[model samples]
Target: MRVLKRLVFWMFGFATLILVTPVEALEKHPLNYVDPFIGTDGTGHVFPGAVVPFGMVAPGPDMEDRGWSYSSGYQYQGRSILGFSNTHISGAGIGELGDVLLQPSSGTKWTRKTVNFRSSFDKVTEKASPGYYAVTLKDHGVRVELTAGQRVAIQRYRFDRSGKVQVLLDLQHGILFGDGPRVLKSEVKTDAVRGEISGTVWSKNWVEREASFIVRFSRPISNVITLPARPGDRAPRLILEFDLRQSRALEARIALSTVDVAGARANLAAFGQPRFDVVVQSARSQWSTLLQRIEIEGSDREKRIFYSALYRTLIHPSDIADVDGRVRGPTGQVIKAETGHYYSTLSLWDTFRGVHPLFTLIVPERVDGMIQTMLEHHRAQGYLPLWTAWGRETWTMIGNPALPVIADAVAKGFQGFDKAEALAAMIATSTDPRPNAPAWAQRDWRAYEEFGYLPYDLNEGEAVSKTLEYGIGDDAVARVARHLGKHEIGKRFEVRAAGYRHLFDPSTQTMRARNKAGGWRTPFDPLVPTSPMNNPGDYTEANAWQYTATPALHDVDGFRALVGGSSGLSRWLDRFFSLPSLGDNKHLGQEALIGQYAHGNEPSHHIAWLYAYSDTPERGYEMIERIARTFYSDRPDGIIGNDDCGQMSAWYVFANLGFYPVEAASGRFTLGRPLVSKAKLHLANGTVLLVERLDMKDVELNGRVISEPTIDYKSIMVGGRLSFPHFTAQVPKAN
Candidate 1:
């Protein structure tokens, strides 16, 4: 009787807790499950969207008229968001694209090319955690929900009344970088629509047009509305409108089908579930699993920031076209998955720098898969991509961080491809003699591989950027060769690392832009980071003062010399920042105070870490903690910028991890602040890298290695649970 009573009491208490408690996964990974609309309303160009673990499709809408900008994909400047699609580009550098565009329009209600359609914020319901988004368009009175599986975008819409609900499907959507739409064929039927769309964005080669739809209306109504009242002509779109009464449940169990509408409807029948609660529930579970990968036990605030950061990182490299691995290729024919995998949208150059590294630790399985994708690029294209979007290399952002990413992945034991082939590709790419440039220009890649620097005379037009980039390449090369056991190669690259000295004007005590002839570029002003004419000489899109000092790494001896000494350098930095904004968003001055440091771009990514290289790494930690806490918030406009895919989040993760990746290739992590007091990173392997007794000051106060800890961070091993600690003791400010 006593046992029964106790059991009953326990069960009753459990039931009560369950009844009273909110959803467990609601905020498990706080930001992960965020309603992406917070900052996306009208502020930042962010999309209130959804995505799965490294999936290639981010199906959203085309509402805003901001003209295909990356972040503000569906500019809310319209009355009604047209429809949901299979793919979308997020926070892209240049512009946006609404791919596989589908809409529920009236008989002939096509969104005017210029009509503004900004819906109230209350209409959109975005489940940002795992991968789900549902919105009720106030203008249309339609309830839309979206979810993502491994490689699919599932959409369901409930219409109050099915009154000629034309489901408009447009093939020609994306930004269309350079290649125009090359849709081979499109097949649209009563219950389905399938098509193939492909064209070049940055390069000429490769075709992709794979789309599928499985739509079921409350009652089949009107007909398919396509472009022009003509046949035997290509129609850019098709609209499916239906007719039904109010209070009718219109369930759209749509599935992405690369094959055909038949396959699509079949797929829908197979997986296009109709339950809204079940769909959201499933999505929550998916996000829960992904976000929990790098679980952190911190304050609610820290968890919020951490999960949000993680959420942002998963926004891009979206699932572009086709589901079930069926795609249209260079030839105007539908082809099955060649490698048993379909992929698209790669921001590797910017992302591989920090984003890919983050994945290395969190999503180890995807690491090898991503590498394989890059390797495929090497096989298809002549070289590994610098920046690829929509199945083509964009060649934006310098530095082939692919080398570092693959090296780091392999080092961390992610082996799903042929390392030898990967190595060969890296070596082949590294040995390339010349970067694409004008005839008279000194080749960067080749000179980097051969002469250790872009020879001064060779760099006639854009000299400074050449020198700096070479310095970066040298760092990447050194790290690669050093780890790959190419000792001689590493040594050679290390020699090239000193090329920054070519710009080092000893007499001026600054690393000014120097001419190839070993002379300071005359009529020079260190503050003007750009070229001599000052219009656009390509000092890597930034002026002189910001690029001159290499503070991010432990270039103690180098920076010391440039400023004539450590104190002098500190004093220079002090004066450098004490001034007002220099009238440039790139410099981060007017918005965020700093010397020449530009939070708007990538050049300054290492600037905060410079303090780590300084005599006071703790100062770096202080600065990082302050910047992260100040700049990054928990709102729609939370992040200061595009999160640069993951660079921003990378900074936070490393800062929270109590370390920062200061270099592209170097395994060395400059110490920084710990966002969490106690954080453990569960690694694939069993061992752990314990970061205990860590305080913001611990990195500086105990500068000396206490454990014979010559951290041979030639490359990091992402093995297991990493603990980010908070120390009780605080280091005093430098006297």
Candidate 2:
């Protein structure tokens, strides 16, 4: 009897303990789960820097190596630290924008070579969170802490021993990729009375543009030494000396603008006398607010990967407008952004597939601003941006990629931008000839209009890829036209959208290149890949097998009929994935292979989810699970390929939520298996959406069973619970 009473007492005490524990104590702040270094190594090409979400200035360490791997100016494998730069490009294949290099050194004299000032740091002392990064310089015994506001980079240098300190400013410093220095013209001026130094650098790299910068110091400058430019140097360097005997620390604020030095000064003044720790806290708070929008139930590792990807998706299409709303337009003229801001760094080809759709759900406010920016670019340049960075068109990628993003916004009922003007811009970009066209843009639109497709003989290269991409763009234009009640224009583009059928060869069951004489090109191989840079083949960064299965999101029934029935389409997909990948000669864009399905590239991103169009969505679930398990992790080399300004990460984010936007402009998302057991989407519409995976086959939205294989965007935005069955009924929720 006594032992039984003790057992009851123990059970009672345990239940009481559980009841008293606060629920908030069990959860961690979203910022704690983000690891900024996940994509810093391997082919990820992402920078582990200190910058707010969509901020203009990203300050990070530039490594000794300036190769393709260091496109973001920092590589995990590199050991030595070149000076930190105020601007950087995140996850770009081509390196550019390493401007305004600053190095805090113990040496007082200016060396002719900048390499002498480089320091070696141990990896153990390196630390990074969302908005803060810190490292210890081994040679000088100084600790470097970096933080940022929207347009300013706050840097704090703490010395172990106080004496003399010299900060070197290289006006000509910029990222290079085997091409020589990019600085065309640069000039600098120092004001000892104001404790400020300002400069302008006009560089021609990925895109030719001018950047102005101003640097403000916390302490008065003791002296300034100017280093003469060598015979081959483009600009002079300056060394500012500071006596740190009184204090062992120094702080500097660096602000940048595409307008002019006055704009840079205005940007600097916007953040008045910012304390380093206070700025760091504010940045963290901003990240936390965005990250908390989606709450999920998963393991620690899962949370780390999810939040890290979420962190990267918010890094680009950065806000480049100054505090006074002044911005440099595409023509290099100062223009005032009527929307109070302007955004740049548009990687449209990769982003239109997933990134913009994701933005409409959680961050709808930024969508209007981005659309306005594109419209502004269209006004300055003749067409929408193919690939842009720093308010300049690079003409890097092919096709009209921006149309789908705008059309998707219109279809989703976003009212922030002028829809009729957006439709006109899309039509003009599609039909009008661009000025000073690049080689890829020099195609004969007359022939395309006559033949309903771009012929391999008439077009320079990427004949099949361009035809299919143009068809997709036309479909987007048609969708917007129809929504705006322009029935005639919608009908015209609908006919043009079906032009992809002309290139589909029924014999090989693939998209084959055709000549102007209406004959198929010879020497065709479905398995062999092609690239625009190396071999100007029929496809762009892909092969026939991948392009043939391109998700016809605009017309599912027509694509199914062309491929055979649903069973035939499923068989084609099975064969596509079951076949072996091409050998080492495959294009660099093709990586992270699952059979022939390349998750590393954008063209194949929607293919895995294409299984939903067939009878077997279970197969797509299997592929998505395999991809998430194999390609992503919490390490430095986690990402399998370039983040491509967040498209790759956006794919993972949507896939994890159990659905994907197969057609970005179609307002429909096909279902897939959910990775997390439960997720809460805190949408911008002031409603909470709860998604859960249960032991059932039918999907339920707000407790009502969904009969179709897809869900529309409106239903998701309305804010309700969406429940899906587990891939296997026996499988339990992730702990």
Candidate 3:
């Protein structure tokens, strides 16, 4: 009996050991239950805002453009929100406005001055899913819920706080930086605007939006808000609110339809018909799936904020319909409901920098929807959208960056849109260096697509810098076209690919802009960033020097030339980032620091990856590893810039995986330092791809020389294919 008992005990011990219970029993998966308040407390960079997957705009808070460029969403600064607009810029950098604004106000006349609606009494709870957001405005004693379909917005506002409340609507609101308007219409209730909306930014692309309501408050407001008789004499924005009491229960359902307003309302009435609790539950479940995709072991606070930020990304494209998926389009014309789904409101310039890219990783299927929307907008409006707010494409930035976005998607193997149509769009957009062009104009980058260099006369950008940096996207498009069997087109692109040297000036030893006569600009300052035709040098949001090392075309080879030779280039790059700043005004807004590296923006997101493209793979690993451990933390200070949708996070996810997409739309990735050692991608294909960062210790966070490096990382894919620098694996001879 004693021997048998000993044997049983030994068996039990063995089982327990093999179970491998780490420090924690995985008590909560990263996505199990997440608090939605972490990112809402600061720059409000991450809005607890709501929308559909890959939506164009989101209806949430606006800080009146007080913070950074993308602060158009909910801001952490204010107490009473102005109102929710049908159009909003997503993941932007310099910030602007869209069309269709509506706000809940107390007194009669709609005021442009911000109203103070602070409440010591209640709190707001916002739960966001793939296509919706719900919030209970506590002080107002109201429960408000919202959702987006494809192009419409539906709002359900419940009144209870005061018992006798009014729901106000204002249409005279939109945020524009310089000479433009954020608002197109300002009125109370209407028959068709049905609370209709329409307009465009300086960009020439047109937009349209509408809002409708189905109030089922516990009680109705005895007093109605005083609004204007005609919208002509007023600012084109919307302002109105519903009043209620605190003790009573109020519930509302909002839906969005990319088809039309009625369709939007219908979609809301249908899909959103589930009990409020049910909708909330569904949203939570969806969030669970997205968050669970990547489980991180971290503190409770970090998890809350991380989950909250992820939720914020889904705020746009809110439910806009009842059940049939019908929503209003930008023309204010009610259209048939989307067969699948339609989404709107994309601040492409800003999001293209990060947010959209991040979505490509988490929700790739939605990418096709988002990309098609941009193309459709191009067909309807003439030019590709810049700061697409709600349905209006508010012209903000310079480049029609959808090129890069489409290229990236194609490279990642995403589908849903017609590839031929997409290719047609890309090839058309290849040239015509005019300040702006019709949507279908730039079919192909004119001469030498690969080597197309930006002339210094463009006045903006690191003109010459954009020439080099932009080649990557051109090459990316060419790669996809070639893969699709357009070899003739590919051959042409291959030759143009090396044309990045057209702007190179050996005298200045940097990429300089060439004039029509092939002469380099005499006065140049790479550090002084400027924009097109503007009285500046450099590029938009950054300096010329900052964009110089942008090895978008092909890093390994590009670096070789910039430094004169591979060996010399490797040493120079190592020491270059370690040097001090030439100190220019380039440090504006999110352009915070400069050690010859813009930790504040996007162009440098891949700067550290340059080392991996070099012969000293060890140096690349060390730099990336150190940066991951330093710049990215699980704290409020965790992000270096406005999460710019998901660009910042994508950079984190990529570097952590030990590789980052060198060009936004390229199939290539340059190895970099990684945060985690190993990760697996759950691709659409049945195949599961694994990435191992090997060992990356001895990282130099403070830019100090790396005294030690544990890993030798060359720019290679997880599949073991050499990316650039032309390293070939020779077959070993049999012994």
Candidate 4:
């Protein structure tokens, strides 16, 4: 009987050990949970490639097809490989930057056209991770592996049954959508003795830019043949042949720079003679370190989705500065970065809402550098970037969104940047107009200063949307101005920020377009989505319903008053989601709709969180839960829309943690439902914040019960524990 008791006790002890072990310890490495292909299909538009976090060299396979779907150059549905390019913009609506293409062929004839050298690959053989991508070309039996450093792309090719292997270096290749950028000029130099190929290509795409690259090969080159440019192609191509009679494997390190080929050479020399495996390991380590910041306890699928979303969040605002801190300024002049690091790929209109706020929490080190880069942009271009890539302004989206980012940094108390200079840049960007700016970029400062709001008749289009957006920017400037003790500037911009109230129509209970004379525009349809590019309605990529709640970010109390108090606001929200969606329109940025709430675009991202101000705060949590469950998954088509340089993914990361930056520059995060059972936030200030869902409505910060539905950035930074003690066991059903 004693022996039986001992056996039972031992079994119970072993069970306890298994149950008590941390989920993170029992599972695979954080890097293993990241699925790079999650957003590669449908409208996700993210690339499945080898890239270090915010690396300049996103080396990936470029597809044969050239259009909207191939924005990242690689789509999950694509079957053919048109070589690999060293640079690509991930999750961009407009495609560009597929520079320095290298394709390996095992044919007897030398081909001039890219189609002749293109090879089809099977999906089963293709594999990708955080920093590594590999695929086998079936036609030529050549295996391609790609990896990257911050500025260099490392490629390895293994030829099966090899005799003579050739690599085509196509200088004219780039991702072409509607009227995409083409090669304006190009120059190539080959050195057979040194086994190096260096060149520069000047192209006019989303922006006119130049990229310089130097390719250093591990094997000796047998011959160099320059291919003539095809019809309508200006830049030339080169075919480098290697005698693979003795060896079957070849490796090439391609370094890129915006400054010059000399800069590219310097970039290459920075990481001296590192093997492909070493670079891959280094990239994996870097991703693991960043992913380790937020640890959660959840199912394998949940972890995969969560970590994959986290992976996408760190991919952009790429390090554009070379190793020596030399970068091409916004006005196309070579300049040295003051901070030794300069970043581009600023999708401010989209990212300032969620991505930048997330950065302040987990990656505070990068925030200053990004702000510095924006300040430099204002100095060079006379305005902050609307949307920029590779150190040049694209002027793609609407609004003065950079203000929010700078203001958020200041409000968070990050002292790495110059506060006065940042305030000046924000004021200039908001109030000043550039002479050489595009018509769309010139936001009619004269009319705005005179009338307080951008009138429909005066502005080109998107007048209502621009007015709302400008009001948000003005609010951001006012916050910074007040913080800096500039009382007059603060009060002036504060009044300007309230300009959104003028367009609010109480009769229709929706924001209406008005002319400069304060007369409402005729034939107002609230449900119709609008854009400045195509459907020239008053909205920007959204309908009237989405913008209804946008102003709430700045002044929740004022917005509540405008919409007839808290209960009325709640009822309006209920109607907003209950109404049937117009339909899916990718071009209009309307998809993944919960009624009129377009989760696919940036405008609707924060509307659900506004439930905090309503009578039914649980309603907001319910909607958040539904959105997370319905729109996100672990599949290739997991994301509802373009990641938009990680904004979409950042939203998921914030929502999963049970809060979101409703007003990105406000320094306060509104509480919602916590998706994860528990989350551990390793803050940049060396404090760890533990967030857990308990069985009550009141939230506790480090054992202190908080009555409010919001928490400030200072509280999170000086972290301990944030407990959400209120939630249903199952997802609350929508009323």
Candidate 5:
């Protein structure tokens, strides 16, 4: 009865509830289960701000310090908010773009100190939904509500008493480059008749770009106060003081554009000036419609965590192009999207693992757009993008991540992308020696051609990481070629995909860096963890034990053989998970450790599935189940590590869904013990894939028992029922 009463209360206040008894209750909409604050407290770095799915504008609060904890611009532990900004990065290790801040204040003297004008708020008064956030400012006795459209952020401020209220637009406020972004151009002008403040800000921190925005208010302003500044200089702020004597509520609609101020105006015009409640309703509708693609049956807590993770997966690889398809290219040229909407902020090194695969499942239309964008980038530059921001290839992380994504799309029979052009791009990236590009951007094809792998002594790079990633890329290329019936290209790259073997050291039974003389680097400590980037002789953000388990996606049989067959591999995995750490000096920031397996990082992402190739498949199930339960939650500090632009959240989404993609482009997903009782995947092809867990060792597809536990992309896309009769953690012999 107590549970029933709480459910009733939750239905009215928290959820979109339907009246029914507990035994006959209907599953809640996925949007109703999302908790935006899950990753805001810990090192998860996810901002609990308002954003539409794949929307460019992530409007949220910014803290005083742009330190590691506040990388996303908002931390749950923060006591006060400096201001609300229009742009925010979600779950990234680096910080950028808290651009165009607006603070609502009452009785504020003109002061440059942010602390003086800041407002403190209690967590109890704060509320966040899919596309809305609200909090009561204790200092100003005002209630601020935030909601966003595709390109606009609407803020509604409700004051307790009617008086003169000021809205401060601070152009100098940003969360990048230590304190603030370097302003290259700033212009803030007011149209008194229209009650609008228009501005253009060109700034450079992580990436140099331009943003033009317009702020329109509900009431006319009595005074326009531009803060004092030196001669021939742009002031950082513009204060609009309005006499609220006639009304107690004030609203501001802000729109951003990467092109020009006119573009911003056009965006605002297209969004329509709906009332705050209507806008909030529209935002909620959008989220509810998008999140309804997947249906899962679980407890309230499980549903909350699952939907929150699903929300995070759609936040990045943002749509950077405007409604007119006009965007700034890599070289700052005004490029127009010829085919579809061009997107930016591709964290390929992290996202290629799980996030993109999720896209291929439910949002294949967006996948087509991403491929078109990548091809456009290749046309603009010489090669595909590594990690892009604002259409500029940042070369942030290692590997040709774009290859696997494109290959995966092609393998799944996703159309509207040119396969021949994609193959040419892949070959060009692999063989072409980009002399002018940075060392990090250019994959050393000459070293690869000569040594078959990235030799530590020969290349100035993280040898093991480069070697493993290149092999994965090669395998992806081969899969795409074969899928297109280009057998020659497939066979050629199939041999190249075996290059990971060159790094395998039989004596140590782990992948190690080989010197110019083909000898293992002395002091080869497989158990001792080191930063893969800093300790560059062998790894990148991981040690030998972790890197050795990689590239198994395409060659698990060969990998098992190299580790002395299934029994030997099983023994090594046991050692890898049992030992906590080698020495007292634990690697800082390398977290979510299970033995040498670093779940916090991307390289070890596929390790949990490798045990399926061993004799002890049950061990893999137990490890995965433990990881799913221990490493995630629905609290403010729910996530265990940096979400890595939704990659961490993507892992959770897959692990809880009963399967995961082991290979990026293989078009196959390996099975694991399902965490939920049942799930229905609504695919883009207008078909539903149903999964039900039963207590048995055998599996079935559409009522026909299957020999293998894996499911192919074609099977999932075609849509049918998949059943697991039983899930148990008992060791069994390999099939």
Candidate 6:
């Protein structure tokens, strides 16, 4: 009987340990729940490739053709792989940088036709994680696996049969905006004995810059071929052939550098050849460290969406500096990085709204690095960047969005940046009408300086929208100036920050486009979108009705007064939400509508939070809850629009955390219902702020109940528990 009892006790103990071990491991990590493919389909335009957090080499497959679907190089519906490129742009509207495209082929002849060499891939067999991607090519019967180091991309090809296998390095196959081939300088050669190829391709698109690469293979090549450039083609194809067909596996390493091929070679040497599994494991470990910063408790699906969103947010603003800290500047000069890292691909217009603010909370280290990059751009190009990519500025969007990034970082107590240089850059861009500035900003510069608003009579499309955006930019500059002790400059900018109010017509109760004579434009319709093809329309991408809530960001009180009062504001919001305009809002760029609130774009991100200040906290909670639930999901088509350099994803991150950065660089977050049961924010100051959604009636911090609808940056940085109990409209009076 004693022996039998002992056996039963041991068996029960083993069973209990088995059940608890997995749960403990899962509780410690949320990275495994990340779905990299969540936004790859539909209009998400995110790349499902192998990259560490802010990696330089985003190695992925490019489709056979160019279009909106191929913006990120690879679309989920694309069936063929022309070649695997070492560098790519993520979540961008324009397709560029399929540089150093390497493809494995079995034949000797180089064919121009994509069907001759491009392999058909099975989407079902494709597997992707935060740091790894693997797909099987049906034509060559080769399995391709991709993983990356900080500066190098490693591709491993497993072939079914080996004999005269060749790797194609196609420099001519790249897309800029559409199906038209991009122009490039001719300089490419492959060395047979060394198994290496080095060259540079200078492509002109939205930004004209050069990309140099060094590709090294593990095996010796039997032959090398360089095809001649076709008609009107400046770039030609280069191929390397391996005679060892009996070998089952082959490896290739592509190191990209914006400076020079030598820089690329240095990058390859920094990450020495490691086994495929070791490289993949290193990538996974790096991503795991970054993703574990925010620990969340929620359903499996919610965790998947949350972690995936977090993953996408970190993919952009890539580190362009080589291992030796050398990078090509916007002026075609080789500039040594001052901060040990220089990042490129600044999608400032969209990211300044939410992504950079979230970076201030979790990845403060990168925030400082990004700010330094902007300052470096100013030093090299004489102006701050609005839409920078590959060390070149593109005239893609309007206003000075980089201002908010700097202001938000400074407001959040982040250090390690040159504040004086940042201020100088902001002032220079605000005053100077540089020819390279976005056309709208340049065309309306005079009106903006004299009339304090972009006038519609100038025939500048998007006059009102640019006015609102410029106002936000001015407000950011004012906040930063005040922080730097420039009281007079701060005061001047503060007055200028009210530029949006000039367009607000009291009679219409909507911000309208005003002519040079300071009168609202006639025949105005609030439901019409501005001209998308070119500027000169009243708005940029939205209608007057959709943009009506924008001024609420800086002047919530004044905005309420403009609408009449709290009651009037509430009634206006009710009509806006219940109105039927959303059903007919087929604007190409606008998406994810709840009535006129376009959740898909950045302008409407703050509208749902307005209810928090409208004397109806309950309405705010309900609207935010609905927005969170209805607009987001954990699938391939999860995103309703372009991730827009992770701005859309950042909105989800903050909204799920129970607060939102309604105003750009305002240093204030308005309250909303948090989706997670509990979340612990690990701030840069080595403090933890716990957020809990308890089933009670009061909102409390650390133990005491608080009545304020808004929280400042200092409160969160100091660290404590922000508990939101059951919300109701009958709560304590507003503070």
**Best candidate according to lDDT:** 4
Clashing pairs in 5: 532-540, 532-541, 533-541, 694-725, 694-726, 695-725, 695-726, 696-725, 696-726
Which window of ten consecutive residues has the lowest lDDT sum in model 2?
Answer: 726-735
Which candidate, 3 or 4, has the higher lDDT?
4
Residue 234 miss distance in model 1 (angstroms): 6.5
In candidate 1, position 235 carries an lDDT of 33
lDDT by residue (42-102, candidate 1, tens digit) is 3234666666655555667666423423344554344456567665565554454455655
lDDT minimum window of 10 residues, candidate 6? 726-735
Candidate 6 regions off by >4 Å?
A: 1-28, 107-115, 438-444, 534-536, 582-587, 727-735
CA RMSD (A), model 5: 5.6
Clash pairs, candidate 2, are: none
Candidate 3 lDDT by residue in tens digits, 34-61? 4433334343255545544444345565
Model 3 lDDT at residue 54:
46
Q: Model 6 over residues 428-506: C-alpha lDDT tens digits?
A: 7777768655544553356687898878787557888878887777877888899999989898888888877788777
Report residue 474 deviation for candidate 4 (angstroms): 0.4
Model 2 Cα shift for residue 672 (angstroms): 0.9
Ranked by lDDT, the better of candidates 1 and 3 is: 1
Q: Relative to the unseen true structure, what is the Cα RMSD of model 6? A: 6.8
> For this target, which candidate reaches the highest TM-score against the unseen true structure?
4
Please give, for residues 475-548, the per-residue lDDT of candidate 5 as tens digits.
88898888878999999888888988988887777888887678877877877555544444557777788888
What do the candidate models score in CA lDDT, each in turn? 0.53, 0.83, 0.49, 0.87, 0.79, 0.78
TM-score quality measure for candidate 4: 0.95
lDDT agreement of model 4 with the native? 0.87
Which whole-number lDDT from 0 to 100 does residue 344 have in model 6? Answer: 78
